[model samples]
Target chain A: MAEKRLMYGNHALVEGIIYAGCRFFAGYPITPQNEVPEYMSIRMNEVGGVFLQTESEIAAINMLFGAGAAGVRATTSSSSPGISLMQEGISYIAGADIPVLVINIVRGGPGLGNIAPAQSDYYQATKGGGHGDYFTITLAPNSAQELFEFPKLAFELAEKYRNPALILADGLLGQMMEPVEFTFEPIDPGKLPEKDYALTGCRGRPRRVVRSYDLRPGKLEELNWKRYKKYQEIIKNEQRYETFNDKDAGLIIIAYGTCARVASAAMKMARDKNLKVGLLRPITLWPFPKDKVAQLSERIKDFLVVEMNCGQMIDDVRMATQFRSRIHFLGRPGGGVPTPPEVLKKIEEIMGGGR
Target chain B: MTKEVIVAGFGGQGIVSSGIILAYAGMFEDRHVTFFPSYGAEMRGGTANCSVVISSSPVASPIVAEPDVLIIMNEPSLLRFEPRLKPNGLLLYNKTLIKSEPKRSDITIIPVPANAIAEELGQGRIANMVMLGVLAKKTGILQLATLKKAQRIRYKKASEEQLSLNDQALERGYSFL
Candidate 1:
């Protein structure tokens, strides 16, 4: 039987990572996302998994990098500032083409910002917070239920691409509780893709070298091209998003994570008053569903890009529409999340006079 | 149909736990539920609250601007949430803490002495359970048995004495209405 229970988003995410065959976890405590590691501290022991309270976010990501390169399904979670500290390790992990899962339970930021929900990390997560010409397959889950599914999906995608997959969640989703049932079967770690490049004891076989450094002049450029080709494949085959009430929508709201959930409520409110508004929520922030938005932009005239940041995803939306569709941005920079009524007001403002 | 509820009170009043219990009851009855609690500085002994939305259909948003059921456990919460209650909504408050009555005549207000009832049961900390009892009976949002079942599940890990005291508080509060 399918397991059903009420779970906080952070707890569900920890359970999801465990169910997805993660045998190693290392992270530091941070607000909003502290529950993720807290739950792992207890539950990981119960599952016979290794859990580490690392010294810092840098140490945690490097631990994950080591575990991931050793062909073990490993994970690490942190909030925005902590994730910022993991960028160098993430860049190395990507450069080495290792499969690992990184979770960012995003809070307000620019500098030691408050621990409230924010989607300001869109650029940081999708546009490569790490210094590299590579991308991580990023999944944004709006609810605790989706929190259970995305970790498994993230692991699978990471293994398939031989690169890191990130789960980008906000403080609201991480802290909120909702009913969740594990929709997928627990993945067997033994059945997962075997990394031929893993540094296992050789047993007379050829030893594998897994490092980010490539000193040879042309060799480094060739390695970057290989990474770009893999990114293109992820972009082509892994783009994911969801559309609601868009068939006849005169206005479309582009949002993700917490903003998408609020926009869904606003969509219902607008429809009740007979306003033709719709919502397009990107489930995968990187490898974003630009084609779907482009297809809709041909039919829809007005687009409202709502976020919890000072307008980051708006750039991607404009790029998707080729700057042809009428676009308006609604966002709060730091801790404030726009409520459903506020989003409904934005919808009306856009429909009233293109304002 | 969707029922949006806001439970508010000072810190340590079990404001967020009350919302969680209500949501658990809704889930027990096979309804979709969302529970969003206040975070950050508001959690440090100041006013705290949580929003719960129970719906027959999928809950769109957890943010409840105009709640159909507004539960205020203290005077500050009443002042903060009273104006936001929808017209013809159900307003449940603790008469023990809130001395004044609600200003709105458009809604149904039920003032239960939650603290007094819990004190009678020898556990004043379970006042939120008392309010939950009144909410279940008055609004018909969840059946009495369902609420009790939810309480049992919530306190499954709690001590035996604590469970019985909560049971007494809930039944006493239910009978008060």
Candidate 2:
């Protein structure tokens, strides 16, 4: 039998990292996401792992890049502002093809916004916030249990693609406590495939040099094309989503992270009110389940993209639907959480208009 | 049908853990449950709150806006969330902390002197557990046995003396009617 415990989302992430054989964590604390580093400090020490609180987010991400380049499972986490600081190092990691897990427990932002939950970083996460023609695999988890499980999936995908993976959580999901069962068998780090490009002592072999600087312009263009092709492959194979009561529904709601949790309640309220409202919650923000939304759009007449920001993800929904469905946007920007009743009202208005 | 609730209070008062116990009991009864907290800075003397949602089906929303129930552990919480309660919802107020009477007549207001009762039971911090006992009795949301099971699970690592005192506190609250 599996041991069940009521754990907060940050603690769940720590457990997930441990289960995924992540032995190193370097991060700077920020609100909503601070518990992850705190939990890692105590738990990592108990498990004989290294948890370093770096001087800054930039140093933390660079440490992660260094650790990941050495062929070790490593991670770093922060909220929106801190993640912004680490974007440059993240771009370097992507260019170097290093597998690192970066978790962003999103808070209200643009600048040092409030330490409250918000999905305002959706665009930055999905569209590659840093300067590059590169995309990181982004996973959005709405529940604490998914917060626990997503790190494992993130690590697997990061290693498989040799790319950085992001767990785009928010303050609400990061702070929540829920019963979680850690029944999966522990992953063995020794059993993983050996990396050929790692910096671990290239004895009696050709010198290994990892750099993004290709002095020849054509060589850099070829490298960019190679990375873009990898992103295309991920777009095809890694697009993931969860559909609830969407088979026969007329109105479909697209949401992610904390917003999805609220939308789920709205779906229930709509069901009770006898309105046909369903949900298509995307777990992967990048390589976004666009094909699934496109297919659902063919049958549904109306679509609503609900988020915590001022219509950041609505563009993605519109792009996915290709102007086929009547798409509407509802949001509460600047750290305000949308209530279920508010979402239900939108669903009712949309259904009444027959748009 | 399962009802979702949010209990708000200070950190040392056990409000968050009490919500966890209710959620645990709900899960034991095979109901879907979630407990989301507003801790950190709010926990250090500010207004602390947690939302617990229990449903017969897989819970749709973990965020409780107009909760079916609200257990206010302090005056601030009552003032903050009283207006957000659904009409005819259950409101359990700790009379020791909230001296003023509720203004609403639409909802069921149960004024239990939980803090005073816990003090009588020799543990001031267990006031939230006392409220839990009253909530279980008045709402019939969980059995006393299930509550005991939850208590044991929560305090399994504690000393026997602490467990006994907590058990006495729970029973005293439950017997207070």
Candidate 3:
């Protein structure tokens, strides 16, 4: 059934988490993302789950450690500075190989940035903000429907790799309201399979230990290598991106999240002018969708990278193409969004004013 | 067909809620709709505005750089947003609250005495419903019947009397032209 309803992006994320069988949510109140914790306060209780308004972002992530270590699907959300404070805890979670969901409703940043939408944290979320030789599965959603659907996918991916998953969204997507069609049945956490590594009561089984450090000699190296193999497998298996009007095109626009929506509008404008312009939107920030870009480079040459930041994801696109680099960037730092007309102008300039 | 509308006024006025009601009604009629509020520190007892998009196709960007229709509920918002109105667009302002007239000659300008009409029906807060009624009768974007149903969802806590007051305000503005 096409079960559609109008809801805010943050509220959709909460419902997505609850529907994915997440029984525990811990978060602190922050602008653009306050709705996540605020809605959780009520919906978690209604779903017989636990919602904690923690004193700080640090406490929230550590609380998630306790719940996640016990084999419960636990999560926490915050904005830029708050995400920064959770770095140590995230490193701890990564070190212990825990499956947890962390959401960053990103805002303009570097310091105490204003509460407007920005994608400045692309490097932070994808390259592992916390100190470790570890990577989290990162998913970027562009619409309210995708916001509603990505949580379940993130949870499954996190559990599959026994790693953390980050949903890198922005304030614009969080604050906007749109109709969302629920696609999946609500998952029942009760009937789910038991996690073999959980520190649940050691009633009949041997006591299990979960820790990030193996302090004995080369033991830490061995554990790091093991996680490396998992990352390699993930890199080989998981790379998600979207393409529009890519065939027989000379230029393509690469963006993600809110930026991609604007790029799409610009691409439509280009197409209306009969320009051979296309769009490539990466859904998964990690694993980077490099292979697709590399393949598309064989046919398409010029690429425009639009973002709400000065330029972060542009590095990934450059590395993906490797010296065939005809990449142009349009960015609006400090929480401003680039409009379709401005983006179209860039596309036209890159296209020599026409195809 | 796609229609982008911006509703602007002071904080207490139902500017954001009016956008939501329009979007909600658009959804009921099988149209793709998006409502985005301009949320900032400026919204605290200050000027507030919101963007609403109703489209036959999927909506692209939630931000409205150019609006097909501009609904001004206060004096400050008229000059702030009037320049962004599309050529030959509709400029609908509340005559009761706004003293300045739109100077655009290309666009169709309508000044509705929304506050006065709403006061005649009891509350000045429901003047947004009056503006919505004018928008409905002019553009054919949404229906008054569907909007009434959508308001019940938006004002779920409103008493029967308040709801009836809103319906009358809409009815009065719908035929007031």
- For candidate 3, what is the TM-score? 0.98
**Which numbered prediction scores highest in lDDT against the true structure?**
3
Error of 1 at A183 (Å): 1.7
lDDT digits (tens) for residues A75-127 of candidate 2:
99999999999999999999989999999999988899998889999889989
Ranking of all candidate structures by their lDDT, best first: 3, 1, 2
State the lDDT of candidate 1 residue by residue for B1-177, as single tens digits: 899999999999888878888889999999999999988877546899999999999998887889999989999999999999999999999999899879999999999899988888887889999988888778777877887788888778998888878877777777777
Q: Which candidate number would show the highest TM-score if scored against the true structure?
A: 3
Please give, for residues A156-266, the per-residue lDDT of candidate 1 as tens digits.
899888999999999999888999998877777788777898888788998789999899879999999988989999998988999999998999999999889889999
Task: Show the colliding residue pairs in model 2.
Answer: none
Candidate 2 CAPRI-style tier: medium
Per residue, candidate 3 scores C-alpha lDDT tens digits across A1-355 of 6857999999999999999999899889899899999998999999999999989999999999889899999999999999999999999999999999999999989899999999999899999899989898999999999989999999999999999999999999999999999888999999878999999999998999988888899999999999999999999899999998998788999999999988888888889998888899999999899999999987677889999999899889999998585989999999999988899899888887676
Docking class of 1: high
Compute the interface RMSD for each candidate structure.
Answer: 0.8, 1.4, 0.8
- True A-B contacts kept by model 2: 0.73
